[model samples]
Target: MEVTYLCPHCIGAINALDNIILSAKTEKNKHGLILLHEEIWNYSVIQTSSINAELGEIVDFFCPVCHASLNTEKGDHYAGYIRMDASGQESKIVISREYGDRRTFKITGEDIESYGESARKYMYPEWFL
Candidate 1:
């Protein structure tokens, strides 16, 4: 059986199951990463190494406010409210969180569902690096 892998630019791991979705952390400072039905959110900064993840898995990072460690369970998708441009656009956007440069990278919906039906489920995001 041949194991398919994700695009190096997008996911880690040299080989991942074809039916298995993958996510690579682009950012470093990710306090929290959540995967909801249609959106992905990152709470704070997370300083660590490259992230290589699979579906139905938990990625442990950190907490922005309390600076405590946190765990985020990945689902098919997830979402949260976000304020845009400080204008209070208050948009409910779909996205994925990738930590880098002490900032969280908000990925577009296309990026979240890039893996198709094999979307990875985030879980127990307390391990950083």
Candidate 2:
């Protein structure tokens, strides 16, 4: 039977439970909540975008399960750098993707720092202006 769950983000009702017959021969269900969290993260990624990285490549983002905002420390092989400005919180990462003729991306540490400050200033104009 498919069980229903109330999604925390959408605030909507959804099915969550699944029927599974466990054999008595099995010792234990070794996995627990952490595994569940990992699954949740994967689910979020699938639900959010159609674009995806290639095999062996991962575009790491915030931990969707924990809802703790994440910052990218370094870019990937495809993109040089990425920066995010959300709710006055600044985050940055260097990423790469195959976009038309552009194959690689890179950003300097100084540029990242400058971008962070610029984001902060944009959010609070009185402080910088």
Per-candidate local distance difference test: 0.28, 0.24
Q: Count the backbone clashes (under 3 Å) in each candidate.
A: 34, 10
Residue ranges of candidate 2 with Cα displaced over 4 Å: 1-44, 47-54, 57-76, 80-87, 96-129
lDDT of 1 by residue, 10-117 (tens): 223222222222222323322223322221232322222344334333244332223332223343223222213224322222223321211122333323222322
Model 1 clashing-pair count:
34
List ranges where model 1 is wrong by over 4 Å. Answer: 1-47, 50-63, 66-75, 79-81, 96-129
Q: Write the residue-wise lDDT of candidate 2 on 1-129 in tens digits.
A: 222222233323322232111111101212112101112112121221233233343332222233322223333222221222223332222222211211211122333322222234322212111
